[model samples]
Target: MSPTLLVMLIMMAVPVAMVFVYSTLSNVVMERDPEFVGIENYLTLFGDEIFRKALGQTAIFTVTSVTLHLLIGLGFAMMLNSGLLPRLAAALFRVIYILPWVFTASIVVILWQLLLNPNGVINYLLEAASLIDSKVEWFSNPSLALGTVIFINVWAGYPFIMISLLAGLQGIPGDLYEAAEIDGAGWRARFFNITIPQLFPILLAVAMLDFIWNLQQFPIIWLATGGGPLNATETIATFTYNLAFSKHEFAMASASGVVLFVVSAIVALFYVRHQKARD
Candidate 1:
Protein backbone atom coordinates (compact mmCIF):
# COMPACT_ATOMS: atom_id res chain seq x y z
CA MET A 1 0.00 0.00 0.00
CA SER A 2 2.79 2.44 0.79
CA PRO A 3 4.53 1.77 -2.52
CA THR A 4 1.27 2.15 -4.47
CA LEU A 5 0.43 5.35 -2.63
CA LEU A 6 3.85 6.83 -3.33
CA VAL A 7 3.59 5.97 -7.00
CA MET A 8 0.12 7.49 -7.30
CA LEU A 9 1.29 10.67 -5.59
CA ILE A 10 4.24 10.96 -7.89
CA MET A 11 2.39 10.17 -11.10
CA MET A 12 -1.03 11.80 -10.65
CA ALA A 13 -1.01 14.11 -7.66
CA VAL A 14 2.27 15.83 -8.49
CA PRO A 15 1.29 16.58 -12.07
CA VAL A 16 -2.12 17.91 -11.04
CA ALA A 17 -0.53 20.14 -8.43
CA MET A 18 2.02 21.42 -10.93
CA VAL A 19 -0.71 22.20 -13.44
CA PHE A 20 -2.73 24.06 -10.85
CA VAL A 21 0.30 26.15 -9.93
CA TYR A 22 1.06 26.77 -13.57
CA SER A 23 -2.49 28.00 -14.11
CA THR A 24 -1.82 30.91 -11.74
CA LEU A 25 1.43 31.86 -13.43
CA SER A 26 2.26 33.79 -16.59
CA ASN A 27 3.90 32.33 -19.69
CA VAL A 28 5.15 29.19 -17.98
CA VAL A 29 7.55 26.81 -19.83
CA MET A 30 8.51 29.71 -22.07
CA GLU A 31 9.98 31.97 -19.37
CA ARG A 32 12.85 31.07 -17.08
CA ASP A 33 11.21 32.96 -14.24
CA PRO A 34 7.45 32.93 -14.77
CA GLU A 35 5.64 35.52 -12.67
CA PHE A 36 2.67 34.60 -10.56
CA VAL A 37 -0.41 36.22 -12.07
CA GLY A 38 -2.98 34.76 -9.65
CA ILE A 39 -6.20 34.17 -11.62
CA GLU A 40 -5.21 36.38 -14.52
CA ASN A 41 -4.82 33.40 -16.83
CA TYR A 42 -8.27 32.14 -15.86
CA LEU A 43 -9.73 35.59 -16.42
CA THR A 44 -8.20 35.75 -19.85
CA LEU A 45 -9.46 32.25 -20.62
CA PHE A 46 -13.00 33.15 -19.60
CA GLY A 47 -12.90 36.26 -21.77
CA ASP A 48 -11.61 34.45 -24.85
CA GLU A 49 -14.40 33.81 -27.31
CA ILE A 50 -12.79 30.61 -28.55
CA PHE A 51 -12.50 29.21 -25.03
CA ARG A 52 -16.13 30.05 -24.33
CA LYS A 53 -17.22 28.38 -27.55
CA ALA A 54 -15.17 25.28 -26.81
CA LEU A 55 -16.67 25.07 -23.34
CA GLY A 56 -20.20 25.22 -24.74
CA GLN A 57 -19.41 22.66 -27.42
CA THR A 58 -17.80 20.43 -24.80
CA ALA A 59 -21.01 20.50 -22.77
CA ILE A 60 -23.07 19.64 -25.83
CA PHE A 61 -20.73 16.84 -26.85
CA THR A 62 -20.61 15.34 -23.36
CA VAL A 63 -24.38 15.53 -22.73
CA THR A 64 -25.39 14.27 -26.16
CA SER A 65 -22.88 11.43 -26.08
CA VAL A 66 -23.94 10.27 -22.63
CA THR A 67 -27.66 10.49 -23.43
CA LEU A 68 -27.37 8.59 -26.67
CA HIS A 69 -25.07 6.07 -25.03
CA LEU A 70 -27.62 5.38 -22.32
CA LEU A 71 -30.59 5.15 -24.66
CA ILE A 72 -28.92 2.95 -27.24
CA GLY A 73 -27.28 0.81 -24.57
CA LEU A 74 -30.54 0.29 -22.73
CA GLY A 75 -32.31 -0.59 -25.98
CA PHE A 76 -29.73 -3.16 -26.94
CA ALA A 77 -29.49 -4.62 -23.43
CA MET A 78 -33.24 -5.06 -23.31
CA MET A 79 -33.27 -6.69 -26.69
CA LEU A 80 -30.48 -9.08 -25.80
CA ASN A 81 -31.97 -9.93 -22.42
CA SER A 82 -35.53 -10.40 -23.69
CA GLY A 83 -34.97 -14.07 -24.62
CA LEU A 84 -37.07 -13.55 -27.73
CA LEU A 85 -34.18 -14.21 -30.05
CA PRO A 86 -32.70 -17.65 -30.51
CA ARG A 87 -29.52 -18.32 -28.56
CA LEU A 88 -27.32 -18.36 -31.64
CA ALA A 89 -28.77 -15.11 -32.97
CA ALA A 90 -28.37 -13.40 -29.60
CA ALA A 91 -24.74 -14.47 -29.40
CA LEU A 92 -24.05 -13.19 -32.90
CA PHE A 93 -25.73 -9.88 -32.23
CA ARG A 94 -23.77 -9.46 -29.02
CA VAL A 95 -20.51 -9.93 -30.90
CA ILE A 96 -21.47 -7.41 -33.55
CA TYR A 97 -22.72 -4.80 -31.11
CA ILE A 98 -19.62 -4.97 -28.92
CA LEU A 99 -17.21 -4.71 -31.84
CA PRO A 100 -17.09 -0.92 -31.86
CA TRP A 101 -16.24 -0.71 -28.19
CA VAL A 102 -13.31 -3.09 -28.65
CA PHE A 103 -11.68 -0.95 -31.32
CA THR A 104 -9.01 1.62 -30.38
CA ALA A 105 -10.07 5.25 -30.71
CA SER A 106 -7.81 5.75 -33.71
CA ILE A 107 -9.27 2.72 -35.43
CA VAL A 108 -12.79 3.86 -34.75
CA VAL A 109 -12.03 7.31 -36.18
CA ILE A 110 -10.34 5.85 -39.26
CA LEU A 111 -13.21 3.44 -39.86
CA TRP A 112 -15.78 6.19 -39.65
CA GLN A 113 -13.70 8.50 -41.84
CA LEU A 114 -13.63 5.94 -44.61
CA LEU A 115 -17.31 5.13 -44.34
CA LEU A 116 -18.36 8.78 -44.09
CA ASN A 117 -16.23 10.01 -46.97
CA PRO A 118 -18.14 11.65 -49.80
CA ASN A 119 -17.67 8.75 -52.18
CA GLY A 120 -17.65 6.07 -49.49
CA VAL A 121 -20.05 3.21 -49.09
CA ILE A 122 -22.41 5.12 -46.80
CA ASN A 123 -22.80 8.04 -49.20
CA TYR A 124 -22.88 5.74 -52.18
CA LEU A 125 -25.71 3.75 -50.67
CA LEU A 126 -27.61 6.86 -49.70
CA GLU A 127 -27.23 8.24 -53.19
CA ALA A 128 -28.24 4.94 -54.79
CA ALA A 129 -31.33 4.79 -52.60
CA SER A 130 -32.08 8.41 -53.42
CA LEU A 131 -31.98 9.28 -49.77
CA ILE A 132 -29.41 11.95 -50.57
CA ASP A 133 -29.26 13.76 -53.89
CA SER A 134 -25.77 15.06 -53.30
CA LYS A 135 -22.72 13.99 -51.37
CA VAL A 136 -22.62 15.38 -47.85
CA GLU A 137 -19.33 16.41 -46.29
CA TRP A 138 -19.69 14.94 -42.84
CA PHE A 139 -16.43 16.20 -41.32
CA SER A 140 -15.97 19.33 -43.45
CA ASN A 141 -19.44 20.77 -43.13
CA PRO A 142 -19.76 23.00 -40.06
CA SER A 143 -23.46 22.27 -39.75
CA LEU A 144 -22.91 18.50 -39.60
CA ALA A 145 -19.39 18.04 -38.16
CA LEU A 146 -20.41 18.16 -34.51
CA GLY A 147 -23.32 15.81 -35.06
CA THR A 148 -21.16 13.48 -37.10
CA VAL A 149 -18.54 13.23 -34.37
CA ILE A 150 -21.27 12.80 -31.78
CA PHE A 151 -22.68 9.95 -33.82
CA ILE A 152 -19.30 8.28 -34.03
CA ASN A 153 -18.76 8.73 -30.30
CA VAL A 154 -22.17 7.27 -29.53
CA TRP A 155 -21.48 4.28 -31.76
CA ALA A 156 -18.16 3.64 -30.04
CA GLY A 157 -19.37 4.21 -26.47
CA TYR A 158 -22.76 2.48 -26.23
CA PRO A 159 -21.50 -1.05 -25.78
CA PHE A 160 -20.05 -0.54 -22.30
CA ILE A 161 -23.40 0.73 -21.10
CA MET A 162 -25.13 -2.12 -22.88
CA ILE A 163 -22.93 -4.72 -21.24
CA SER A 164 -23.29 -3.17 -17.78
CA LEU A 165 -27.08 -2.89 -18.07
CA LEU A 166 -27.30 -6.40 -19.46
CA ALA A 167 -25.54 -7.70 -16.38
CA GLY A 168 -27.89 -5.70 -14.14
CA LEU A 169 -30.88 -6.99 -16.07
CA GLN A 170 -29.76 -10.56 -15.64
CA GLY A 171 -29.34 -10.02 -11.90
CA ILE A 172 -32.94 -8.93 -11.49
CA PRO A 173 -35.10 -11.50 -9.74
CA GLY A 174 -37.17 -13.64 -12.10
CA ASP A 175 -39.80 -14.00 -9.37
CA LEU A 176 -40.46 -10.26 -9.29
CA TYR A 177 -41.16 -10.28 -13.02
CA GLU A 178 -43.37 -13.35 -12.60
CA ALA A 179 -45.28 -11.68 -9.80
CA ALA A 180 -45.79 -8.61 -11.96
CA GLU A 181 -47.12 -10.80 -14.76
CA ILE A 182 -49.45 -12.55 -12.31
CA ASP A 183 -50.84 -9.12 -11.48
CA GLY A 184 -51.91 -8.85 -15.12
CA ALA A 185 -49.14 -6.41 -15.89
CA GLY A 186 -48.45 -6.06 -19.60
CA TRP A 187 -44.90 -5.94 -20.97
CA ARG A 188 -44.93 -2.15 -20.73
CA ALA A 189 -46.12 -2.25 -17.16
CA ARG A 190 -43.57 -4.85 -16.14
CA PHE A 191 -40.84 -2.91 -17.90
CA PHE A 192 -41.75 0.37 -16.32
CA ASN A 193 -42.48 -0.92 -12.85
CA ILE A 194 -39.96 -3.71 -12.54
CA THR A 195 -37.16 -3.47 -15.10
CA ILE A 196 -36.63 0.25 -14.92
CA PRO A 197 -36.82 0.42 -11.16
CA GLN A 198 -34.42 -2.47 -10.82
CA LEU A 199 -31.99 -0.93 -13.29
CA PHE A 200 -32.13 2.65 -12.02
CA PRO A 201 -29.05 2.47 -9.80
CA ILE A 202 -26.91 0.91 -12.49
CA LEU A 203 -28.24 3.37 -15.04
CA LEU A 204 -27.33 6.35 -12.91
CA ALA A 205 -23.87 5.07 -12.10
CA VAL A 206 -23.07 4.21 -15.73
CA ALA A 207 -24.35 7.56 -16.98
CA MET A 208 -22.15 9.49 -14.55
CA LEU A 209 -19.10 7.48 -15.53
CA ASP A 210 -19.88 7.96 -19.19
CA PHE A 211 -20.30 11.68 -18.67
CA ILE A 212 -16.83 11.96 -17.13
CA TRP A 213 -15.30 9.88 -19.92
CA ASN A 214 -16.93 11.90 -22.68
CA LEU A 215 -16.06 15.18 -21.04
CA GLN A 216 -12.38 14.31 -21.42
CA GLN A 217 -12.69 12.60 -24.79
CA PHE A 218 -9.94 13.84 -27.14
CA PRO A 219 -8.59 11.18 -29.44
CA ILE A 220 -11.83 10.46 -31.26
CA ILE A 221 -12.76 14.08 -31.83
CA TRP A 222 -9.17 15.00 -32.60
CA LEU A 223 -8.71 12.29 -35.15
CA ALA A 224 -12.17 12.75 -36.61
CA THR A 225 -12.23 16.51 -37.16
CA GLY A 226 -9.46 18.02 -35.02
CA GLY A 227 -12.21 20.34 -33.79
CA GLY A 228 -12.35 21.96 -37.19
CA PRO A 229 -14.81 23.15 -39.82
CA LEU A 230 -14.98 26.57 -38.18
CA ASN A 231 -14.80 25.30 -34.62
CA ALA A 232 -18.00 23.35 -34.98
CA THR A 233 -16.66 20.45 -32.93
CA GLU A 234 -14.27 22.33 -30.69
CA THR A 235 -14.25 20.91 -27.17
CA ILE A 236 -12.37 21.60 -23.96
CA ALA A 237 -9.96 18.75 -24.65
CA THR A 238 -9.11 20.04 -28.11
CA PHE A 239 -9.08 23.61 -26.90
CA THR A 240 -6.52 22.79 -24.25
CA TYR A 241 -4.38 20.96 -26.78
CA ASN A 242 -4.48 23.86 -29.19
CA LEU A 243 -3.52 26.30 -26.47
CA ALA A 244 -0.64 24.35 -24.98
CA PHE A 245 0.90 22.65 -28.00
CA SER A 246 -0.26 24.64 -31.01
CA LYS A 247 0.03 28.13 -29.60
CA HIS A 248 2.48 27.37 -26.76
CA GLU A 249 0.31 29.33 -24.33
CA PHE A 250 1.10 27.13 -21.35
CA ALA A 251 -0.42 29.33 -18.68
CA MET A 252 -3.74 29.73 -20.46
CA ALA A 253 -3.78 26.05 -21.31
CA SER A 254 -3.15 25.14 -17.69
CA ALA A 255 -6.00 27.40 -16.66
CA SER A 256 -8.31 25.77 -19.15
CA GLY A 257 -7.26 22.35 -17.90
CA VAL A 258 -7.91 23.43 -14.32
CA VAL A 259 -11.39 24.53 -15.32
CA LEU A 260 -12.06 21.13 -16.84
CA PHE A 261 -10.69 19.50 -13.71
CA VAL A 262 -13.09 21.44 -11.51
CA VAL A 263 -16.08 20.37 -13.55
CA SER A 264 -15.02 16.72 -13.51
CA ALA A 265 -14.29 16.86 -9.80
CA ILE A 266 -17.77 18.20 -9.09
CA VAL A 267 -19.35 15.36 -11.06
CA ALA A 268 -17.12 12.85 -9.29
CA LEU A 269 -18.05 14.27 -5.92
CA PHE A 270 -21.71 13.59 -6.64
CA TYR A 271 -20.84 10.13 -7.84
CA VAL A 272 -18.90 9.43 -4.67
CA ARG A 273 -21.75 10.66 -2.46
CA HIS A 274 -24.24 8.56 -4.38
CA GLN A 275 -22.06 5.49 -4.01
CA LYS A 276 -21.76 6.08 -0.29
CA ALA A 277 -25.52 6.39 -0.02
CA ARG A 278 -25.95 3.15 -1.94
CA ASP A 279 -23.50 1.41 0.31
Candidate 2:
Protein backbone atom coordinates (compact mmCIF):
# COMPACT_ATOMS: atom_id res chain seq x y z
CA MET A 1 0.00 0.00 0.00
CA SER A 2 1.05 3.59 -0.57
CA PRO A 3 2.04 5.66 2.46
CA THR A 4 -1.28 7.57 2.44
CA LEU A 5 -3.25 4.36 2.21
CA LEU A 6 -1.21 2.81 5.01
CA VAL A 7 -1.82 5.83 7.23
CA MET A 8 -5.58 5.75 6.58
CA LEU A 9 -5.73 2.05 7.34
CA ILE A 10 -3.86 2.49 10.61
CA MET A 11 -6.06 5.37 11.62
CA MET A 12 -9.24 3.39 11.03
CA ALA A 13 -8.01 -0.05 12.01
CA VAL A 14 -6.59 0.82 15.43
CA PRO A 15 -9.89 1.91 16.96
CA VAL A 16 -11.81 -0.93 15.34
CA ALA A 17 -9.35 -3.47 16.66
CA MET A 18 -9.32 -1.90 20.09
CA VAL A 19 -13.12 -2.00 20.33
CA PHE A 20 -13.30 -5.63 19.27
CA VAL A 21 -10.60 -6.67 21.73
CA TYR A 22 -12.20 -4.72 24.54
CA SER A 23 -15.64 -6.17 23.94
CA THR A 24 -14.33 -9.74 23.85
CA LEU A 25 -12.25 -9.24 27.00
CA SER A 26 -15.16 -7.62 28.79
CA ASN A 27 -17.45 -10.54 28.04
CA VAL A 28 -14.80 -13.04 29.06
CA VAL A 29 -14.10 -11.23 32.30
CA MET A 30 -17.79 -11.09 33.06
CA GLU A 31 -18.19 -14.80 32.45
CA ARG A 32 -15.18 -16.00 34.41
CA ASP A 33 -14.95 -13.49 37.24
CA PRO A 34 -17.42 -13.05 40.04
CA GLU A 35 -16.62 -9.33 40.12
CA PHE A 36 -17.98 -8.97 36.59
CA VAL A 37 -21.06 -11.09 36.15
CA GLY A 38 -22.40 -11.99 32.71
CA ILE A 39 -24.73 -9.36 31.30
CA GLU A 40 -25.22 -7.96 34.79
CA ASN A 41 -23.97 -4.60 33.59
CA TYR A 42 -26.81 -4.43 31.12
CA LEU A 43 -29.21 -5.75 33.72
CA THR A 44 -28.09 -3.04 36.10
CA LEU A 45 -28.59 -0.44 33.40
CA PHE A 46 -32.21 -1.49 32.83
CA GLY A 47 -33.05 -1.96 36.48
CA ASP A 48 -31.32 1.10 37.87
CA GLU A 49 -33.73 4.00 38.23
CA ILE A 50 -30.94 6.56 37.98
CA PHE A 51 -29.65 5.13 34.72
CA ARG A 52 -33.15 5.01 33.26
CA LYS A 53 -33.77 8.59 34.34
CA ALA A 54 -30.48 9.69 32.86
CA LEU A 55 -31.40 8.08 29.55
CA GLY A 56 -34.74 9.85 29.55
CA GLN A 57 -33.10 13.17 30.40
CA THR A 58 -30.60 12.72 27.59
CA ALA A 59 -33.37 12.05 25.07
CA ILE A 60 -35.27 15.14 26.17
CA PHE A 61 -32.21 17.34 26.01
CA THR A 62 -31.16 16.09 22.57
CA VAL A 63 -34.61 16.50 21.00
CA THR A 64 -35.31 19.92 22.52
CA SER A 65 -31.92 21.37 21.69
CA VAL A 66 -31.87 20.07 18.10
CA THR A 67 -35.41 21.26 17.43
CA LEU A 68 -34.79 24.76 18.75
CA HIS A 69 -31.42 25.02 17.03
CA LEU A 70 -32.90 24.12 13.65
CA LEU A 71 -35.84 26.48 14.03
CA ILE A 72 -33.77 29.49 15.13
CA GLY A 73 -30.90 28.83 12.75
CA LEU A 74 -33.15 28.41 9.72
CA GLY A 75 -35.14 31.49 10.73
CA PHE A 76 -31.98 33.57 10.92
CA ALA A 77 -30.72 32.22 7.62
CA MET A 78 -33.99 33.11 5.91
CA MET A 79 -33.87 36.62 7.34
CA LEU A 80 -30.35 37.07 6.05
CA ASN A 81 -31.32 35.85 2.61
CA SER A 82 -34.50 37.97 2.39
CA GLY A 83 -32.62 41.06 1.06
CA LEU A 84 -34.40 43.27 3.55
CA LEU A 85 -31.12 43.60 5.43
CA PRO A 86 -28.09 45.29 3.84
CA ARG A 87 -25.33 42.97 2.67
CA LEU A 88 -22.80 44.29 5.18
CA ALA A 89 -25.27 43.92 8.06
CA ALA A 90 -26.15 40.40 7.03
CA ALA A 91 -22.49 39.42 6.75
CA LEU A 92 -21.75 40.90 10.16
CA PHE A 93 -24.66 39.04 11.75
CA ARG A 94 -23.51 35.78 10.20
CA VAL A 95 -19.98 36.30 11.45
CA ILE A 96 -21.19 37.05 14.97
CA TYR A 97 -23.42 33.98 15.01
CA ILE A 98 -20.58 31.78 13.76
CA LEU A 99 -18.35 32.84 16.65
CA PRO A 100 -20.16 30.59 19.10
CA TRP A 101 -19.40 27.49 17.03
CA VAL A 102 -15.73 28.46 16.92
CA PHE A 103 -15.39 28.71 20.69
CA THR A 104 -14.22 25.68 22.70
CA ALA A 105 -17.02 23.91 24.55
CA SER A 106 -15.33 24.65 27.87
CA ILE A 107 -15.28 28.35 27.13
CA VAL A 108 -18.93 28.41 26.19
CA VAL A 109 -19.94 26.47 29.30
CA ILE A 110 -17.89 28.68 31.60
CA LEU A 111 -19.31 31.80 30.02
CA TRP A 112 -22.83 30.46 30.43
CA GLN A 113 -22.14 29.56 34.06
CA LEU A 114 -21.43 33.21 34.74
CA LEU A 115 -24.39 34.37 32.73
CA LEU A 116 -26.83 31.97 34.40
CA ASN A 117 -25.67 32.34 37.96
CA PRO A 118 -28.10 33.88 40.37
CA ASN A 119 -25.93 36.87 41.19
CA GLY A 120 -24.20 37.05 37.84
CA VAL A 121 -24.37 39.72 35.14
CA ILE A 122 -27.61 38.48 33.66
CA ASN A 123 -29.56 38.63 36.88
CA TYR A 124 -27.96 41.93 37.78
CA LEU A 125 -29.03 43.49 34.53
CA LEU A 126 -32.49 42.01 34.75
CA GLU A 127 -32.82 43.41 38.26
CA ALA A 128 -31.70 46.84 37.13
CA ALA A 129 -34.31 46.79 34.39
CA SER A 130 -36.95 45.65 36.89
CA LEU A 131 -37.45 42.53 34.81
CA ILE A 132 -37.46 40.34 37.93
CA ASP A 133 -37.61 40.74 41.65
CA SER A 134 -34.61 38.58 42.55
CA LYS A 135 -31.88 36.42 41.19
CA VAL A 136 -32.79 32.85 40.21
CA GLU A 137 -30.63 29.85 40.96
CA TRP A 138 -30.49 28.46 37.47
CA PHE A 139 -28.26 25.43 37.86
CA SER A 140 -29.35 24.67 41.37
CA ASN A 141 -32.98 24.38 40.39
CA PRO A 142 -33.69 20.83 39.24
CA SER A 143 -36.72 21.83 37.20
CA LEU A 144 -34.85 24.49 35.25
CA ALA A 145 -31.32 23.08 35.05
CA LEU A 146 -31.84 20.70 32.11
CA GLY A 147 -33.80 23.27 30.15
CA THR A 148 -31.16 25.88 30.88
CA VAL A 149 -28.41 23.58 29.63
CA ILE A 150 -30.40 22.82 26.49
CA PHE A 151 -30.84 26.55 25.87
CA ILE A 152 -27.11 27.11 26.20
CA ASN A 153 -26.35 24.20 23.89
CA VAL A 154 -28.78 25.51 21.28
CA TRP A 155 -27.39 29.04 21.45
CA ALA A 156 -23.81 27.85 21.10
CA GLY A 157 -24.50 25.22 18.44
CA TYR A 158 -27.05 26.85 16.12
CA PRO A 159 -24.39 28.49 13.97
CA PHE A 160 -23.56 25.16 12.32
CA ILE A 161 -27.22 24.70 11.38
CA MET A 162 -27.43 28.32 10.23
CA ILE A 163 -24.44 28.01 7.91
CA SER A 164 -25.76 24.76 6.43
CA LEU A 165 -29.24 26.20 5.88
CA LEU A 166 -27.78 29.41 4.46
CA ALA A 167 -25.76 27.43 1.93
CA GLY A 168 -28.87 25.49 0.94
CA LEU A 169 -30.87 28.74 0.70
CA GLN A 170 -28.25 30.31 -1.55
CA GLY A 171 -28.32 27.29 -3.87
CA ILE A 172 -32.04 27.81 -4.40
CA PRO A 173 -32.53 29.79 -7.62
CA GLY A 174 -34.08 33.24 -7.14
CA ASP A 175 -36.34 32.78 -10.18
CA LEU A 176 -38.52 30.45 -8.16
CA TYR A 177 -39.24 33.22 -5.68
CA GLU A 178 -39.79 35.73 -8.46
CA ALA A 179 -42.20 33.38 -10.20
CA ALA A 180 -44.01 32.79 -6.95
CA GLU A 181 -44.25 36.53 -6.41
CA ILE A 182 -45.69 37.07 -9.93
CA ASP A 183 -48.21 34.33 -9.24
CA GLY A 184 -49.33 36.24 -6.07
CA ALA A 185 -48.06 33.65 -3.63
CA GLY A 186 -47.43 35.09 -0.18
CA TRP A 187 -44.13 34.76 1.75
CA ARG A 188 -45.43 31.87 3.86
CA ALA A 189 -46.72 29.97 0.82
CA ARG A 190 -43.53 30.43 -1.13
CA PHE A 191 -41.44 29.35 1.85
CA PHE A 192 -43.53 26.30 2.60
CA ASN A 193 -43.74 25.17 -1.02
CA ILE A 194 -40.34 26.13 -2.41
CA THR A 195 -37.80 26.75 0.34
CA ILE A 196 -38.65 23.98 2.80
CA PRO A 197 -39.04 21.18 0.25
CA GLN A 198 -35.76 22.06 -1.42
CA LEU A 199 -33.93 22.31 1.91
CA PHE A 200 -35.23 19.02 3.36
CA PRO A 201 -32.06 17.05 2.69
CA ILE A 202 -29.80 19.66 4.22
CA LEU A 203 -32.12 19.95 7.20
CA LEU A 204 -32.17 16.19 7.70
CA ALA A 205 -28.38 15.95 7.54
CA VAL A 206 -27.89 18.82 9.96
CA ALA A 207 -30.54 17.48 12.32
CA MET A 208 -28.89 14.07 12.46
CA LEU A 209 -25.50 15.63 13.13
CA ASP A 210 -26.90 17.88 15.81
CA PHE A 211 -28.79 15.02 17.42
CA ILE A 212 -25.68 12.88 17.69
CA TRP A 213 -23.57 15.73 19.03
CA ASN A 214 -26.20 16.77 21.55
CA LEU A 215 -26.77 13.19 22.62
CA GLN A 216 -23.08 12.70 23.37
CA GLN A 217 -22.44 16.12 24.87
CA PHE A 218 -20.53 15.83 28.16
CA PRO A 219 -18.32 18.85 28.84
CA ILE A 220 -21.07 21.44 28.81
CA ILE A 221 -23.19 19.52 31.31
CA TRP A 222 -20.15 18.71 33.41
CA LEU A 223 -18.99 22.30 33.62
CA ALA A 224 -22.42 23.77 34.22
CA THR A 225 -23.96 21.29 36.63
CA GLY A 226 -21.81 18.14 36.80
CA GLY A 227 -25.08 16.27 36.22
CA GLY A 228 -26.19 17.65 39.52
CA PRO A 229 -29.14 19.32 41.22
CA LEU A 230 -30.34 15.81 41.99
CA ASN A 231 -29.02 14.10 38.81
CA ALA A 232 -31.63 15.97 36.86
CA THR A 233 -29.24 16.79 34.03
CA GLU A 234 -27.40 13.49 33.76
CA THR A 235 -26.84 12.26 30.23
CA ILE A 236 -25.63 8.90 29.01
CA ALA A 237 -22.17 10.31 28.40
CA THR A 238 -21.93 11.82 31.84
CA PHE A 239 -23.42 8.72 33.34
CA THR A 240 -20.82 6.59 31.60
CA TYR A 241 -18.06 8.85 32.85
CA ASN A 242 -19.28 8.57 36.40
CA LEU A 243 -19.68 4.82 36.13
CA ALA A 244 -16.20 4.25 34.78
CA PHE A 245 -14.27 6.81 36.80
CA SER A 246 -16.27 7.42 39.94
CA LYS A 247 -17.93 4.06 40.41
CA HIS A 248 -15.00 2.04 39.03
CA GLU A 249 -17.34 -0.10 36.95
CA PHE A 250 -15.62 -0.22 33.60
CA ALA A 251 -17.73 -3.09 32.28
CA MET A 252 -20.96 -1.28 33.00
CA ALA A 253 -19.62 1.90 31.45
CA SER A 254 -18.67 -0.01 28.32
CA ALA A 255 -22.15 -1.48 28.17
CA SER A 256 -23.68 1.99 28.38
CA GLY A 257 -21.30 3.20 25.68
CA VAL A 258 -22.36 0.33 23.43
CA VAL A 259 -26.00 1.16 24.00
CA LEU A 260 -25.39 4.80 23.13
CA PHE A 261 -23.58 3.84 19.96
CA VAL A 262 -26.40 1.53 18.88
CA VAL A 263 -29.06 4.20 19.51
CA SER A 264 -27.12 6.84 17.56
CA ALA A 265 -26.53 4.41 14.71
CA ILE A 266 -30.24 3.64 14.44
CA VAL A 267 -31.13 7.33 14.33
CA ALA A 268 -28.52 8.00 11.65
CA LEU A 269 -29.80 5.07 9.59
CA PHE A 270 -33.32 6.47 9.74
CA TYR A 271 -32.10 9.85 8.57
CA VAL A 272 -30.16 8.23 5.76
CA ARG A 273 -33.25 6.40 4.53
CA HIS A 274 -35.34 9.57 4.77
CA GLN A 275 -32.74 11.52 2.81
CA LYS A 276 -32.63 8.79 0.18
CA ALA A 277 -36.40 9.03 -0.20
CA ARG A 278 -36.20 12.80 -0.56
CA ASP A 279 -33.54 12.47 -3.22
Q: Which candidate is the best by TM-score?
A: 1
How well does candidate 2 score on lDDT at residue 182? 99
User: Deviation in angstroms for 181 in model 1?
Assistant: 0.9
State the RMSD for candidate 2. 2.9
lDDT of 2 at 128: 93
lDDT of 1 by residue, 1-279 (tens): 899999988999999999999999999999999999999998899898988999999999999999999999999999999988999999999999999999999999999999999989999999999999999999999999999999999999999999999999999999998998889999999999999999999999999999999999999999999999899999999999999999999989999999999999999998998888889
Q: Would you give me the overall lDDT of model 1?
A: 0.95
Residue-wise C-alpha lDDT for candidate 2, range 202-255, written one tens digit per residue: 998899989988888988888888898899999999988997788766667777
TM-scores for all candidates: the values are 0.98, 0.89
lDDT of each: 0.95, 0.85
Q: List the residue pairs that clash in candidate 1.
A: none
TM-score of candidate 1 against the unseen true structure: 0.98
Which pairs, if any, clash in model 2?
A: none
RMSD of 1: 1.0
